[model samples]
Target: MGTLDSDDLKSGVDLKSQTDDVSLVDERTAEQKKIDDWLPITSSRNAKWYYAAFHNVTAMVGAGVLSLPYAMSNLGWGPGVVILILSWVITLYTLWQMVEMHEMVPGKRFDRYHELGQEAFGEKLGLYIVVPQQLICEVGVDIVYMVTGGASLKKIHDIIWDGAPKIKTTYFIMIFASVHFVLSHLPNFNSISGVSLAAAVMSLTYSTIAWSASIHKGMQQNVEYGYKGKDRAETTFNFFTALGDVAFAYAGHNVVLEIQATIPSTPEKPSKGPMWRGVLVAYIVVALCYFPVALIGYYMFGNEVDDNILISLNKPKWLIAAANFFVVIHVIGSYQIYAMPVFDMIETLLVKKLKFKPTFALRFISRNIYVAFTMFVAITFPFFGGLLGFFGGFAFAPTTYFLPCIMWLAIYKPKRFSLSWCTNWICIFLGLCLMILSPIGGLQNIIKKAKDYKFYN
Candidate 1:
């Protein structure tokens, strides 16, 4: 009436288009689902004890096995084990903060990490910091595993040949890694969940079995790799510094969240409460799964601990072979599963932004590029030397230490900062302090790696 004014017309336009914007978002999401690569680390069924436990081993155990020796070598047993335990505690604190964030925005499907970041820290912050952090963590993890696997190959080669391989071993890792992806269950996840679980079980079983056997065989005592001792002060400094890598081994809380989101609960309604349930159980299970192996491995190779402990063992030929088998399987599964985001970053730039979906041939070419990039970055670097420091300092650095208290402040705004709140507060503060310390280990390890390459060039 009264010839509806400009304000009225503007309001009408706004009301009319709100639905359109939402619909547009839905359309875009649906389109995204069509192309493979939507999930990173979720299993199809809400698996039970096996799923929760296996994921824990797969996610947390890799770095621990490889890096415990090196971590303990500098820090020695007392400092190393204590730091490893403390790092787990810190990670658990950050992990709860992660869960707290999801609670804040329950209605929206806060599936992707960036979405969680968007809800917690606003859109721009999520885009700039959280997402980038996730990408960096992922890339860093890629570097760690690829390097470790390559080094494992080198180790096996050297052992078999009675020294380092005559062959250009990097080429084998590249080819083997590439073919593994091709042969693995394709991009869809349900197919691979069983294998992932199986790999985790086999690796865990083989690790424990081999280690227990070795222990009985009197292989558990500390053995020197014969390197000159570090100065007392320098070694002490390095030991405290190496906590970062141990923290890194304990930093797979992200994967746990992804897992928690997937596994169905036994409770009729699937409440978030601890029925000793999926996500909650996952947190504890992963911790227990990791602790013993790390402790035992450190015990086996004190001060000489390098990275992967199994390879450190002076054992029967078959035991080393079995351990190597499990490690290789573990690495391959991890690579295939985690390789998505790397591809996503590339595709987002090319297909979505550039508006051209690559042909199958083009996609294959991209995969090759990824493999080449992975091998070079890993092998040319520490071959897993700096892995513990990198993840501990970077991925876990932000997520575990700083995020919880800030997230609580942002979302819950608790007044007295209840016991629940205080726990998170300490975690956040401790995480920040530890994160500050996390990189020193990495820097020294990088230097160590650079200085010695295969005892040759």
Candidate 2:
């Protein structure tokens, strides 16, 4: 982030500054025997810097690596590269809109998404655009991670048991839920950030080293094993499917905002510029990481990428070890990042809003209940293909392509309204097209596979 001018220094107010201003503007609400338990927490300080970096990495790492092969197959390697770059550019532009939306508000950055939705687009529209979209998108991400973690679990079972396990996916979900159970309750910001940092580094290192190896091998194959094409299908990308992956890939921006809000300083001139500096850094990182894999995955595997990138790589015995290590790391981090909010929301509803007393027993029960609920998605047992495609194809597009623009327009007042706003509307149109196509293709693919249970069964 960049340093602000003297004027920015004057206006930039953080949580403490907001509270101080509140003391002057409204006295009673500010001084009512207050203690900050952080259950009903304000955004933390210094959060934006780390959050921006973490989310940029997280957004890039999650969907692209594993899902690259599958998405590229439909669109072709060249088109996939084109779309990913295009998406990255569009994503950065829209994210700029989002940041402006936040900066316009001047405080609490995101006090209430719905309220911002109202402010940005007016009451009825914000409710329609911002509220439903965020709720669905956030929950949808939860489901994607659950399913991703479950896929890794099923893969583990195959490795350990030398065969798929009975009630395989259900068992996998349970295992996934068990681990996330610990992470969601954890409130330590630094610990989470540390893990996020390490995971980001580890993922980058492993992916780069492994992908480079794959590229080297690919070069060898091109020269030595020329034209002995493996059996691969011609993938026709349903735009909705591609868009779904796009949305998921560019997510964590919301989480980035949350992290920024939590930073312990006022919204004053930070050590850096919030707009260009923070976002520019994020944009550079994502493009470098995701584009290569999307290209390589398509180049190597054709259409068999499945849900994870490693599947497409199908590396020799050596790289598989590193791949396994990262898959575990991905699942662990994904679970923590996605599920913690669900726990927080549930906590707010139960203990705060419901006026129920917080009890250790209740906490334990709530954790167990949430863990159990994760089962609904995975209970079909040992099935990854159907669920992954269905959600990736269905929910991911709306979450990605459509939601950000909607949220931006709905939440923040714009600088230039008339002609400039049309870009958002244009994005909405494209997003809708994407949402419809991706999910339809994914579900169709899943349905066909399920119907052909003849061989696998």
Candidate 3:
């Protein structure tokens, strides 16, 4: 979405420094060569930094943003705000670290996270670990997208056609997936940056709507405050569980590297300037989008907040329709951004391992089929909120928190017990702690909720 043994390896290998060697240029295998032509154009160097910033912003601020109020409620305002700020600073640092590490290996470009892992760990171990978690986080997020998008569509359906038959969420999921299938034909990750920018705008628009609604409702209702020490306040387990949601809220690290690689860098002029600028701009935008909705939603609804803040509102039909429309559009674009990595991994595997030539028809068919598979799974298990916890705690936390720290340790081998070393381990320890506890909390919540759960309900 986002580690390892030591001692059996070398230190400071300097992947980029080795680029001066004449033999390594364009060292593409036949398989790589074939796939290169088949896949869509992916270089983003010609792209403006604003578009890159938009892509990063949208990728980080999807369904996870909706859960922030609930996360805030669990930890209380003080703790929640503190955690959000900390998560932002730490994740931004790690993201830049990743970008910096990416720059280190100019000799062989790492367009993917697993490739970085392999260089750091010295085997396919990186591939094995990074690939699955990345897929799980991305696909899991996509499933949540469908789930939320279906719910939005169903709401509109009920409003516009008051006497119509009730359709299952599964059908809505299929409809969303069908649309995704059509959009999936657009080649590669770089081409979609503009779409991602538009999606980011939608996200900001809906988030603003949610925030405004929370404020108006908070003003109108004489709701009681549960600052702390209340019966509905979070238990220790709930706090950890909330951390999972918050962790995933910052889970763009998994795709950041992939997005970076798409930026076209010439030998004479590297793309680092635009990349760093874009990343910083993106985080600033993320903070702007996340904090207000969370603070206001928790302020409005307290511990009773819905997993999605939109569903918690009681607004006019027109306003609801507009908000939901934005959400559906945002998720549609978000799904493609996340799914691109998975498609790349599968296509690469097919070409390299099975000796399958990467043809246009094959790429088109395989990717659409993969989209269908994701949709099928979402339809089958529409446990939207529970899936968020599972994916966040199990996949996003490690990818965002644990492994990045481990990778930092491996790459730099910072002075033992120094501040840098201590900080990294602290992050890793926190990551492991959340990884274990949050899932247990998440599962407990899932099991409790499952008692009344029904398929396509």
**Which prediction has the highest TM-score against the true structure?**
3
**Which stretches of candidate 3 lie above 4 Å from their native place?**
1-24, 27-31, 40-45, 162-164, 220-222, 227-234
| Sliding window of 10 residues with minimal summed lDDT for model 2 | 225-234
lDDT string for model 1 (195-267, tens) is: 5676566556655754475455554455653322557656644754566766666645545445444444332
Predict model 3's lDDT versus the native: 0.78
TM-score of 3: 0.89
lDDT of 2 by residue, 95-175 (tens): 665555554645445534454566756779766765455555555555656666666666655655554436546566667
TM-scores for all candidates: the values are 0.78, 0.77, 0.89
Query: How does each model score on lDDT?
Result: 0.59, 0.57, 0.78
Across 58-97, the per-residue lDDT of candidate 3 in tens digits comes to 8888866877987887788788888888888878877877
Clash count for each candidate, listed in order shown: 13, 33, 8
TM-score of model 1 vs. true structure: 0.78
Worst 10 residues of 1 by lDDT: 267-276
RMSD of each: 7.4, 7.1, 8.5
Q: How high is the lDDT of residue 375 in model 2?
A: 52
- Which parts of model 2 are misplaced by more than 4 Å? 1-36, 40-43, 46-48, 121-128, 153-169, 188-191, 219-240, 265-267, 270-278, 303-307, 358-364, 381-395, 407-419, 452-457
